[model samples]
Target: MRKSVLLFVTFVLFGLLSSAQQTKISEFDLYGCWVLENKKRPSTNIVTYKLCENVAHEDVKFGSKISLLAFNESEHESTGPLACFTTFTEKGTWEFDENSRIASLYSGHEWLKEFKQLDPDEYASWGSPEKFDKLKFRVISIENNQLTVEIIPKQYGKKRTEDSLE
Candidate 1:
């Protein structure tokens, strides 16, 4: 009986230790710059995503529903003078769930609430149940600390071809 109890306790402790390997969201881990890896929009080229410090928000809504911790708008800058290039500070909050392989982005002010995330190697948004008006993205490559993202429209046809992206 004593040996069985000791073995059970040891197993439980081992399980807990291994589970801790999964990473949780941290401010420092999110502080770095993330380039646009979406391949759909190539003209704008690259974007610098910086997580600003000493910023806060309150009572933020996720998607059309749900609530989450508040995060502030960070700086967004264009790479060059391309007509497609434009930059603006994103007003929202971001969270990363490593185990789920997902990153959640919540935005839209008090009225137009919407939240979305991209799982690892996935380009689909799992927010709304609607089929149309859904935005998806694909990552082409990451080189020299730059990311190229490809946008996949919900509708695919001659009207929205790759060449039309130009």
Candidate 2:
């Protein structure tokens, strides 16, 4: 009976150690400067956004200060610098599911919403309710002093039509 108890205890300790040794995501994996490459606008107005900066991913606390640059089209010509940037200070809880490789965005204290990971290197920006559904950004080749990022528009709504019965 003594030998059997000793063996059981050893097995439990080994199991706990193995579970604790699992890999965890590091801060550097999300730290970088990202840029925009493409976009789609609404009918009423053409709106585009760009982003840049470092993101922090702690145990349960996630935060990032990013710059947003926007562009607008006017008349029949493209306008210059319709751009204004503001830092998004996000303080929330985060969880990463290794099996599905998804990351969840959560704000425990506020009226914010949840965001899911669309791709390995792409993050779904759950913008204002009036904004588009998703913005797909992929990190392209980094050369010289430039980091190229490709932004593909994936959510453009349908248009309305006028029906005439004569």
Candidate 3:
């Protein structure tokens, strides 16, 4: 009976550890930078994407949502001298769930002041009409160093990044 109990406990512990590993995504795996591949708005099939947009997620030391997103205007057909290499960056923090492979960026929190960096207007089509909300992205697939994520629309009471970020 003792041996049987011990074996059952070991199995339970191992299962818990395995589930924990699958639950949370490590910051190290996302230490570098990731760009936006696709962004579907709140209520429309009109997907907003970037050709060469990049999101530089540095160590959390700098700040939250400090990741930079450089959007190529040519993809939107609004190309111009100042629009070609413009970039829109997040101004808050980043939280990721490994089990769900969802990355939520709390942007639109603060205003940006970089002259070279494009304003959030470039990403006007990304999020919902509400001014206060977080950007939720679920990883579709990761292959060949390319991470494709789908922008999840925010529902009622989903404003800002919450603990129930599903």
The CA lDDT of each predicted structure is 0.38, 0.34, 0.46
Find the candidate with the highest TM-score and give its number. Answer: 3
List model 1 lDDT by residue over 1-166, tens digit each.
9999999999999999998755353333444444322224335533322122211222211111112233533322323346554333434444544443333444443223232233322323433321222223343433344333344444544356678644
Kindly indicate the candidate among 1 and 3 with the higher TM-score. Answer: 3
Name the regions of candidate 1 deviating beyond 4 angstroms: 1-27, 36-84, 110-166
lDDT of 2 at 154: 43
True-vs-predicted CA distance for residue 134, candidate 3, Å? 3.4
> Which runs in model 2 stand beyond 4 Å of their true positions?
1-30, 33-110, 113-134, 157-166
Estimate, for each residue in 1-166, the C-alpha lDDT of model 3 and write its tens digit. 9999999999999999998654344444444444333333346422222223343333211211223223200111112357654444434556677777776655333342331145556555444232334556676655455555577777775454666554
Error of 1 at 121 (Å): 38
Candidate 2, 1-166: lDDT as tens digits:
9999999999999999998764453323323333323333344322222234222222111112222212211011111345343224433333333443332333322232232322322333333332222223333323343433343334356432344211
Give per-residue lDDT, candidate 3, residue 162. 66
User: How much is 113 displaced in model 2, in angstroms?
Assistant: 5.0
Please rank every candidate by TM-score, starting with the best: 3, 1, 2
Q: Which residue runs does candidate 3 get wrong by more than 4 Å?
A: 1-25, 36-88, 108-131, 157-166
